[model samples]
Target: MTRILRSQGFVTALGALVLALVAAIGYLVVFDPARKTVAYCAVMPDAVGLYPGNHVTALGIPIGTVNSVRPEGTGVRVDFEVQEDRALRGEVTATTVSDTLVADRDLAVLGEPGAAPWDRSTCITKTFTPKSISQTLQGFSQLAGQLTGGGNPGEQTRIRDSVVAFEAATSGTGPELNKLITDLGDALRAPDAAIGRIGGLLDSYSRLMSSIALNWDDIEIVLMQATEGIAFINELWSRVVQLIDSLLVILPWLNSIAREYGRPILGALDGALPGLRLLSANVAGLQQLVSMVPPIVQFFEEVIDPATGRPQLTYAAPKVALPRAEADRICAALNGLRPGHCDGAENGLSDVNLVSLVLGTVGAR
Candidate 1:
């Protein structure tokens, strides 16, 4: 006993234990181990595999560990012992997640930027529970089993019959089905052009809708006015129906006339086509010429024949009567090879007025 008490090994061991205890006590004093603050969150009943000592993260970073999780009324109240410096804010949300399907869940707290400060005294009202991978796999399994009818004889028979019918219906259409599939793939792959066109169409439709919205009042007024015209339109429709009946009665005769004389009428039009084309070419000049006709008619009215009680179409330097046929040809004779040819003939007049014959030709009487 004396040897052991005096031994350097025992003394060294004792000094090590003393040093470790002092360091631990210093650490506890410095870190304030007794007074941890907690934030509370009410979590869903199916926190699946969450437990005490599970790491709690805020925004994916570890800020604390779940201190306790216990049933509070209907749901579970989870207390998280968080570092006072890393407390969550008003826009924070807590959820339970796990890294692997079989792993214990961790409470994941997320916070929004620029949110109001979270009060430590108040608990987060709700928690989000994400669907677990096992649940997803179970659902997929159920669907697969259903599709295969879960080995039931009647269901299997029905599935077989349906597949047989489908096969029979498509038996002769392999090439068509192959072509359809190829075309469908091509269409789907080339959808960028279609999508661009659809976008343009949507833009045009949007503009059209906007235009209608802007002019809705005017459109309503116009529609109201159109509604007021329905009575007039009804009367007009009756008259049109009568006119159509009359046309129907005359149609046979009209058709016979067309059949017999269509060629001659078309021939006449063909002959006049050159004149019509010429008139069309000189439309502006023809319009100007037509405008000058009124003045010319007025001038003819001023020159009236007192003796004949008509417009004096025939005017000469010395007035005299010639036969209608002679008067007609007098202008031609004056225009001929002999200059004074008319003077030697009937009344020794120097000339017959050429302008008078022109006026007479134009129905100035």
Candidate 2:
């Protein structure tokens, strides 16, 4: 063993073997294939400071490494691998963040773990790439140039003065600004219950809009009918206004008439009240009398001669044989005398002689 150790060739081979072992150890430490990891992807609008092999972090703690960064269409697709044990689980957002202006950006996985594991098929589409300080400053410079470039010098001066004043006003209020920011943050921080209510409200509003869209035709018909009804109401209102105007014009005449004759008219009505009451009480008799008027008018109309415009009288009598004594009695009674008090009783002639006059008249006819 002493001779082998002292040989120059053995010593050279031993040193080479030690170097090979060290290299293997370094390779295993650098790229351990046995370490389990979960693969994920993210698409970002911009990936300026991000590169392959960059650290992927969760809440600023390193948990993974970016596998690749490549352009896919209009976005940058970032493929990453996280330690399987520390895999991002639920709905999460990826944001590119940097520690400083010059520092390299990292892919930040933000959110707490949820019930389901992360879906490998889907990419993290919800990503934000905030503008770097240099980009922001460049944007401001461009804006300033644009404002000052126009020929309106007064406007340019005003804008510049405004910016200066704003800077001056905000320069020394650091504590107040901090307080304002804190308050704003507090105000924006919604509780779980509030968030749930907001979500429910949005869902209800969505359903309401859908319902309106579906019933748009019926709603349109209702609106049209309402419009027609309004027009009719407007016309009726105009008529009412005209009636009111007419009443206004006639009011003075009515008032004058009332002043001139109202007392006499009231007095007459008061005097006739008993008669009016009696008439009302005999309304049935009045109705019967009114009923007889039509037949009387008909009889008069039948008796009138249309050609001569005069009334014509006609009579028909039945002939009857009466005893002479009874006839004489009737004639005497018609003359306002008793039967025995006739002036010509033996000759059957009275002072008036109505029976003989009627017989003579009939005989002559």
TM-score of 1: 0.40
Question: Per-residue lDDT tens digits of candidate 1, residues 1-365?
Answer: 99998999999999999999999999998656775666666556556788999988876777788888888777788888787677676666778988777888899887665677777677776578778777889999999788778988668676678899999998999999899999999989999978999999999999999999999999999898996699789999999999999999899888999999999999999999999898767778867869878999878777776578786665444434556556547745655633443443355333454454445457553
- C-alpha-based local distance difference test score of model 2: 0.82
Task: State how far residue 327 of model 1 sits from its true place (Å).
Answer: 32
Model 2 CA deviation exceeding 4 Å by range: 12-16, 19-23, 26-31, 99-104, 132-134, 146-151, 159-365
Q: What's the C-alpha lDDT at position 55 in model 1?
A: 88
How well does candidate 2 score on lDDT at residue 290? 92
lDDT of 1: 0.77
Worst 10 residues of 1 by lDDT: 341-350
lDDT of each: 0.77, 0.82
